[model samples]
Target: MNILSLGRSLASFIVVYGGIDLVAVHAFAPLRSLSADGLPRRRLTSRFSAGVDLKQNEDLQKYFQAAEERSLAQFARDDAPAWLQTIASLPFECTACGKCCKTIGSVYLSSEETWQAAELMNISSTEFIEAYASDIIRDSAEASNTWVRLKEKEVLKGTDHSPACIFLNSDTNQCQIYEARPTQCRTYPFWPNLLASPDAWDAEVRRMDHDSESTLLEWTPDAGGCEGMMILDQNSTTLGVPMKDVYRQLREYRQQDRYFPTGDKKADTER
Candidate 1:
């Protein structure tokens, strides 16, 4: 190979596998110093969600690819706590499954989304905050920026009972306030956690399919955990949806969460 090609390869190797300082020092020249976790040393707003900015740096992309590969290898042996594994074999297709909504502490609405839901319900945001939302954070900049709690009602099904969103009708299993649902609810099944890897995908999806409080396998293969939902043969992402479209959906979701935090305050100004 040519000297130029060899140098480029060496730089890529140093960034990915090589440890210590000298992260992405090829063209940019010390854009980031090596941190304890081998990630870039900076006051990062986010690690993976900022797709646009992250993609601009070629070295970061290669570093992510290498890290993901290593994690997948570790997962093969450990098969526990499936973290850092990327690639959700197929795109997620939400069947309006209320399983996710039933889980406690699964949904939290942003400040702006909270008021929008209130207006739809004909209740003022003040009243809604008093009744529906919970004060998780107070006396801080992020105070009320997030941490709106929805109604958690207990519902009986035949022989068992499960916690569900107050808006979820037990008989029909449909969201009452679908139009006014928060961004977290709207971007179900495609959230970064769900898209980490196929194992995570199956574990999350199937666990939701169960009626009981789903628990991950703790001891052995046959242990206290969800077993009702069968391991699906996810041949294609949903049926007709393309992979690109799914990625695009996730990108849009991230962008919306990043740009429009409170509400459409700029809606009138833009118009």
Candidate 2:
């Protein structure tokens, strides 16, 4: 079927799956605090997984939290010319494997992204937020606020239960709002976790492989991570340059508390 047909079908499926309801969205408003060293520690609550011993999962959760903290630190240092050089030198390409979308935890939505996605889905922003989004409490020394992000759905795959972004269509393994996807979704593979250091990038490739077997076996960690996918030369590149620009914009957005441009000429010109 065509793209429009697929979108309509997916929309119908979403509604049937109760995506139109406002009460179903899971809120992750756990009280979070940052340590003296600037690492975030989230309080365990029933919202994550009910009827389970959080004590048993504490260590695992801490490890994942530390990884996020490390990535944030890397993002702080992204402006370094040497780091930019390293990023430019690395070889990379997206095969549209959809592995990242499947593996990532949450797709944080800025206010602009939320509105745009709602429009694309042909729904009011309030309805969209009620059905598909939730508020995440972020506490830090510099900023303490709540941000909206897409909710995850629990899907049973064989004997395992996997968490995926609500917009991910399980049958086709494609995003429903690809054209109007959030900046976080648009700026994948160039994330701080994958660009922090050579070792970090290598680790991410391994992690991706472990998460999704569809990732090519040839894209090994030792070969500089996603070997064939990387841009070998700076000349004649598209994604690489745009990704760098995105990286810069993300930094600016964080520092200035401003929304990224939505590429709407009329809207942007009006602003």
lDDT of 1: 0.48
Please provide, for model 2 over 1-271, each residue's C-alpha lDDT reduced to its tens digit, 9 standing for 90 to 100: 4557545543443354345321221111111222332222232232233322325645434544565445544654655334555443344556555555555355666554577688889999889889998653243432423346678776667845456678878788789998677645664555544555655544544324445655434432123233325323345233444433434434433432333222211111110
TM-score of each: 0.48, 0.48
In model 1, the clashing pairs are: none
Candidate 1, run of 10 with poorest lDDT? 25-34
The weakest ten consecutive residues by lDDT in model 2 span 22-31
Q: How many backbone clashes does candidate 2 have?
A: 6
Query: What lDDT score goes with residue 85 in model 1?
Result: 28
* Candidate 1 residue lDDT tens string, 1-271: 4557545644543544333334232111112222333343332324223322334555555655566345434433354223322323353455555566665443556565676678789999889888775443232444445545565775556845556677788888798778677656665555555555666556654444344564533212122122322333544434433443334334334544453435423222210
